[model samples]
Target: MPEHGHKTPHLQEHLLNIPVPDYAPELRQLVFDYTLQLADTSLILGHRLSEWCGHGPILEQDLAMANIALDLIGETRSLYQYAATLEGKGRTEDDLAYLRSAVEYKNPLLVEQPNGDFGDTVMRQFLFDGFHYFLLKALKHSSDQGLSAIAAKSFKEASYHIKWSSEWVIRLGDGTEESKHRMEKAVGNLWMYSGELFMMTDTEKQLLEAGILPDYTSIKQQWDEHVAKVFSEATLEVPQQVYMQQGGKMGKHSEHLGYILTELQYLQRTYPGLEW
Candidate 1:
């Protein structure tokens, strides 16, 4: 489930890892918050995907899930390293990844939802991938060259994620009667979580204005259109007018995050300083 060990050579490990004063103090803090959120989201989802590493329903998908989990974790590492640099707090990526409290994690509640079943996992991935695809596309043009580089690197992976997840959604939605029913259940159970992906906080709004991130409204539109197109082909209904969950960006989370943090932080907490 874990990616690189908690320890790695800091940002200096990469030629492109250099951090520049790309914004004023206030904006720099905003960028740090945003970057940390991105890292946290990927790390938690990556861990969830990793649970399927040896337990995939089929051999092919098992391997694929592991790879995708690795991709997200890899991206998480880069984002964390960048975040540590921006923090200027003498913290390493390991500290930032493993030392944070439950409320300190900034991932949306959606990603933290337990992976109930294969159908549920697929639905979760598809919903996130849909948004991720467009977010990366916009980030590729970020005025901050460092962020742009990371987004450009991640764009292809996000593209493949949506393609893979979309196929499963279609297959499950349009497959056998049992498969379709399970998929429908997955859709209903997960749809509400989808709204939080686009619910931006003041930090994100500022970043959008600074050209560091894209507008959530526009991203949500693209996400909705893509989801509707896919769900329609799958013979599924895209839920509308649902109550949206918020507060992840503000550090409030569902109960699930506490459990995740306990397990995730165990190795570090037990050891205190070194990477195990």
Candidate 2:
């Protein structure tokens, strides 16, 4: 049990009491919508990574990937559980995650990409972790204690995540010609979708005004510096992609989320109210 007088359920200890905006119903919905978007991205990404359970390059790599996926899943559970509590409409995390239609998810398209090769996986994490690190750092100051506590605690884990991933990025980039080529290609493919993660909506604006959330614009600058530093260390060049894809925060998602949902919600869809 943690010092909070309850047994910490994995990542549950981080659910602190950061005050959110006291907006009326409509504004509350907006803030929740934004928060859910962040949650969904990590949730979906964790699902995708979980698929690599048995097929990792080696046992160590497999365990490493699985551990990372577990961390993401842990983070997702905390975020979703808190979001449900805020909803105050008798909704559960399972209900929000499984019962929602595909159009209701706000996960970015980047997370839905098929995990092709180890290089692809590493490149994807590299891109996303850079952004997540900054977002969580900014979130530590969120007026919402729940989110700020989650961020403060998770930020430590995310730092390790960034370290582990950056090590792989550097190794693959400088290891051999084959690895270098594969990583380079993976970076190119993933770079186009990177911009959407930082794009904020009106809900975010309200949260920022009410001090419920951090300013994403400032976080973007820090993200750029961090990414640039990691890329340089990895001997990789940041792609100068001209076009950027957007629109996942508004319950918009990629084609892959539907397939992911089919599998994720299968048990719940098949047996309503069933639990272990």
Candidate 3:
């Protein structure tokens, strides 16, 4: 395995040194909320992936999933650092990540859902990865330079995640009958949570008006096409249900987020100010 230590300094420099653009208080607050949404989603999903660390069906897949988890957590750190700076509240990334209650987190509910099985995990990842690819692609052109920089870095990893997850979706859907059944079941279970990805909040609306964020209306169309193509290839039926779940953007979350925070915040809550 490669030593990740050599990369730490560079990562820290990028996270700590990104220039924050001067904007109105309202705009800054909107951007801060948007950054928290991004960070929370990444952190929650990364935590889900990390749960697969030693339990993967194969050794190669275990390591690959773990590495992907690391990439997501690293991206989450950068986003949290930027959000802390934007808040101008003397809050560190650790505070934003570890000290917040579930109600304060803005991650989409899809990310907080339990990882039922390998099939469930892959489907969840595929849906999010598809949405994230388009989101990061548009964010790369954000008016906020710091956010754009973070988006640029995150897009590369999102691309890999999309590819990996999409392939697994196809492989399972088109493989053995048992695999296909499980994959299909996973897809059905997750379809409702997927809609929250494109649900724009008031903060996002303001950011859209200010050109700090992309119009998700168009992004949703692109996402639909991308998902449709992948689902067709996977021989999976796309759920046509229009009753999409929402509220995560507004900080209302599913019960699962509470459990996630309990485990995630344990070390920080138990040993305040502790660090390596």
Count clashing residue pairs per candidate. Answer: 0, 5, 0
Per-residue C-alpha lDDT of model 2 across residues 1-276, encoded as one tens digit per residue: 257677646544545454554668875676577668877888888888889999999999898888888888777777777788778788887898888878889888888888989999998888888888888988888766667777787798889888888899999997899999998899888888889877777777777787777777888888788878877877889877449887776767778788999999999999998987
Model 3, 1-276: lDDT tens digits are 558655445555546478877988888888999999999999999999999999999999998889889889988999999999898889999999999998899998899999899999999999999889999999999879988999899899999999999999999998999999999899888999999999888888889999889999888999899889988998999888558999887889988999999999999999999988
Indicate which candidate wins on lDDT: 3
Question: How close is every model to the real structure, measured as TM-score?
Answer: 0.93, 0.90, 0.95
Q: Pick the candidate with the highest TM-score.
A: 3
Pairs that collide, model 3:
none
Which portions of model 3 miss their true places by more than 4 Å? 1-16
Candidate 3 TM-score versus the reference = 0.95
Pairs that collide, model 1: none
Q: Once model 2 is optimally superposed onto the true structure by TM-score, how far is the C-alpha of residue 95 displaced, in angstroms?
A: 0.6
Backbone clashes in model 3: 0
